[model samples]
Target chain A: MRIELALFASLEPYLPEGESASGRRTRMIDLPGGITVGEVVARLGLPDQPRVCFIDGRGVREDAVLTDGVRLAIFPPVAGG
Target chain B: MGSLLRVDMACLTVKKEPVPAGWAKYAGRALTDAIIFAEVPPKADPLGPANKLVLAPGLFGGTPAPNGGRLSIGAKSPLTGGIKESNVGGQFAHSAAKAGLAAIIIEGRPADPKALYALDIDAQGNGMLNRVDDLAGLGNYETAEKLHAMKGDDKLVTVTNGPAGEMLMKAAGIAVSDPHGYPNRFAGRGGLGAVMGSKGLKAITIPLGIESLPHADKEAFTAAVRKFANALKEHPVSGQGLPTYGTNVLANIINEAGGYPTRNFSEGRFEGVEKISGETMREITLERGGNVKHGCHTGCVIQCSRYYVHPDGSYWTKGSEYESVWALGADCGIDDMDGIAELDRKCGDLGLDTIEMGNVIAVYMESGKAEFGDVQGALAALEECAKGTETGRILGDGAEATGMAFGVERIPVVKHQAMPAYDPRPIQGIGVTYATSTQGADHTAGYSITANVLGVGGTVDPLKPLGQAELSKNLQIATAMLDSFGLCIFVAFPVLDIPAAFEAIYEMATAHTGDPWDADALMKLGRETIAFERLFNESAGFTAADDRLPAWMLTEKLPPHNSVFTVTDAELDSVHDFVAETAAEMGISKP
Candidate 1:
């Protein structure tokens, strides 16, 4: 299944080469249907750091399952303005 | 700082009066609000002779305490028609405090409206008002440069008002010279610059002082400062995130949370967010040879500030902070980075509050006076303000005035002040702050985003009203105390999550003032300060009706979550009622 992924701030360096070249910050990734957010992070070779993850604009835990067509967004620890 | 330097602008006289015994411990917003309550009549016209402008430094200002150089400028506001204190980070606080000046109070409007003067303070803290009529219509950048040229010292810090202030536009703010001697740091809210302009004052210059002020318990203070510094460096939010990407890091996260207000609060997110995110900014800065991680003041370990540059490596502006970018980019429907940077630079040069200026331009766009996403149109509108044209005056007066002029109904404001980047519909806690904050629609007044959005202290549901009132109340009280200490608000991240960081604040204050300070004493001080501000607002004719988000926010649901401001009016009243009751328990008086 194909999923949409968005990485921000310090986590942007983890984007795939094609997405990185696009300079759009968002990328499409082909992954297993039953992948969890944690598995996705691991597969993408993300650094061991504090992060906040969201699926389709709703903040969710890493254990949450991902499905095809869902937009997954991840960000490093950020303080408000 | 044992003396209050009072400059009577009408008579062109300066006097150094002994500090009030009761206000000896007060500094920053505490000192500014206290002086305003004592000297400025609540009902006085904000631009009249009766109103006074007060500049105060925080308690740890000029000390070795990291990020302790915040200056608070206060006066009755011409825009909100309420008491206002605008906090800023710059060299002025450290310079002024080193000269033994607790506060500088400017009183009385000049007899001649065209007269303009500059107040110069020497190393000994003696102040003199010099005629500066030639600087009546310059921008803050020009004013700072000319003042430095006149003094023959490029290092001298200057506080200046630009053409917006000279025209008495309500959105005008006072700019403080940064370490680089440019007027980029600003106390940019509630028309304090108009008050300064009304007094016929153009600028203030103070000699640079680098040595740390003496502390009562030097050993303990030093130990506490070290601990605090270590804690800040340890926290992921403050240490890693801020220094790496600056405050603009929140753009992606807030947008992901569906709380980033876009196109004048008509939507929850912006499609162009990625183009303007912190990652993009860092990439651009690195490519352009700009300083991505820079400190606003000396001894700042966080270093969240940045100096944005042109593509060819020329200096453009100091910062395009999260709020400024949101206001000019997302809120105005303009996603171009260079355009937003230009707006930020223009606001700084004109000494206008960027938040207010963006809101006004957004309102103008909504009214068909300009097209949304038209960068040239926005720039032209801002230039109109520089020229003081009729339309420019309306736009320069701030959001509410522009709304009134353009007949736009969806003006996002509280107490006539424009709201910051956060949309209150999805984030109910911040909405409570916007409605109840004494300073009028200021995010730093309460900043419930820590819990409601960022999960710094603890996680709270952003889409629901449960636990919001309590969260806003606690943060608001803590913010009041923090502002008084002259500490950076970013310290709250570590102080909330780390116990030692929390205790360091109390330990530092006790060692600095030679007093028994603790959590309870700090809470009481915060309570008293709120009570005093509430009393002043009451005297200035603010009633319960004034404490609310615009009616449209409560009725119109925002997108994504489709949430409206669900916190009831009674809950909003409870925030201030609790403060009032706490003040009574502490034997504080009413208006």
Candidate 2:
């Protein structure tokens, strides 16, 4: 299945050089069907915890499964007022 | 505990009083709120003789507690016309604490309308009032430079204002010196600096070479401080991400979440986000030989602050926080980091709230004074504010006055104060806070960005209304307690995720006071502080109708999400209800 992977802030280096054609800091990747967010982060060499994932801009559990064309975004914890 | 110093500007007298037995347990906002409630009249003009400005060091202030040097400034706001409290990071509060003063309360306007006095506290804590005529109308940067050279002591920390305050503009903010002697740390909301000016005050300087902050249980406090510091280092957000990128790291994430509040809140996202992003800012700072991991105050291990440098490697400004980036960059449609840095510097040096200044500039743009993204035009307008022209005076007060003066409709503000970085339409939790906060549309009052975007405290859908009121209420309660310890709120990132981190904070506070405390007790304390503020606002003529977002935000749909502030008015009214109810549930009565 084809999915869009978005890496933000400190996680950006994991993405390939330059932004993809989506006009954002995202890249398209291929993953197996029913891939959990945990497995996806692991495949991307990310920690299992302390990272938040959003599917289609909605925060989701790490165990949530991905479907085709799912936009998955991962970000390290960040804060400011 | 130390004595409270009351500086009477009317008669130019200073009196020292013991920390009242009833007020001994309270410090920071707790003590400030109690004093404001007891002394200030609800209907007093915020800039008149009846109002007072109270500065307090938190519970662990003057101690070796990490991030324990913050100071709280409280008064009736000239902008909001209600109770206001703004906190800032600097070396001032910790040194003030070491000087054996728990609080400094400024009251009454002097008979000499042109009188400008400087209050100096020497190393031995001797207080004196002097006439510093040269500092009467200088900007904060030049004033700090002159005062530092005048004092010729590395240990002195100063808090002063620019000509904006000298002119009594409502947008004026008090500037506090960082370690580098730059007056960049600001208690920059609610027009508190104007209050200082109205009192005929110029500056306050405290020498900070004290060997150690007296601690009740030095051994136990040291252990608890060590544990809290270790917990901060162990956390990913506070330790790793913030130290590297500073606060602008949220640029991309907030933009991605479709809640960045671009172009005067007319749009939810900006196309030029990358140009002003934290990643880009970090890259530029390092390439220019700048320090990215600097703390605003000493003993700040989180170090989510930075010193932005010019191309030739000279310091430009200290803060490029997410709000400043969003406010000056996308809010005005300008994307250049260098220009934003310069504008940020001008705002800091002139003692203006960058958020309010940005809002005023954006409103000016919307009025067709200048095209969006016109960097030169924005700079020209800033020059006017610095000059204190007739138009500049209107702009200096904030967006409400600017809109009124310029005949612009669709202005975005709550309680006469400009909204911060996030658009309320998409981020409804913060909308609740912006509407009901005692300080008026302040993000720090209840930073729902933690749950809304960063996923720190708890996950909440930014576009939805469900779970928003509760999220804001809990964070508001927790934040009040944190602010009292003179601790930076950045610690909340770790405390949200790690139970041990929260426990460490509780232990440290309890050890300092030598009193028992738990999560419930902490919440109760925070609730009481907020309750007093609410009571003051209520008596000052605020009603549920005043707790509302701008009318346009309810009707105008933000882009991408096509969302409005769907949080019910009833919900916005209930945002602070948890305080009283929780107090009753815990069988505690707030006087």
lDDT to native, each model? 0.88, 0.85
Candidate 2 residue-wise lDDT at B121: 80
Pairs in steric clash, model 2: none
True contacts kept of each: 0.70, 0.63
lDDT of 1 by residue, B429-542 (tens): 999999999988998998888888786898888788888888888888888788888888898898899988878888998888788889798877777777778888989999
What value of lDDT does candidate 1 attain over all alpha carbons?
0.88
lDDT of 2 at B228: 90
lDDT of 2 by residue, B1-591 (tens): 878999998888887888887676678888888888888998999889999999998887887787778899999999999988899998888888878888999999889898888888876566788888878779898888888888897656999978888888999999999987778899999899999999988899988656666556778888989999998998888888888888898887777778888888888889998889998999899999988887888888888888899999999998588888888899999999999999999988888898998999999999999888998988888889888899899999999999999988978889899999988888888988898888789988888888887888778888899999888888888888888777788888888888888887778887777788777777777887788788788889898998999988888988878888889988887888765675465343432
Alpha carbon deviation, residue B173, candidate 1 (Å): 0.5
Minimum summed lDDT over a 10-residue window in model 1 chain B is located at B582-591
lDDT of 1 at B259: 88
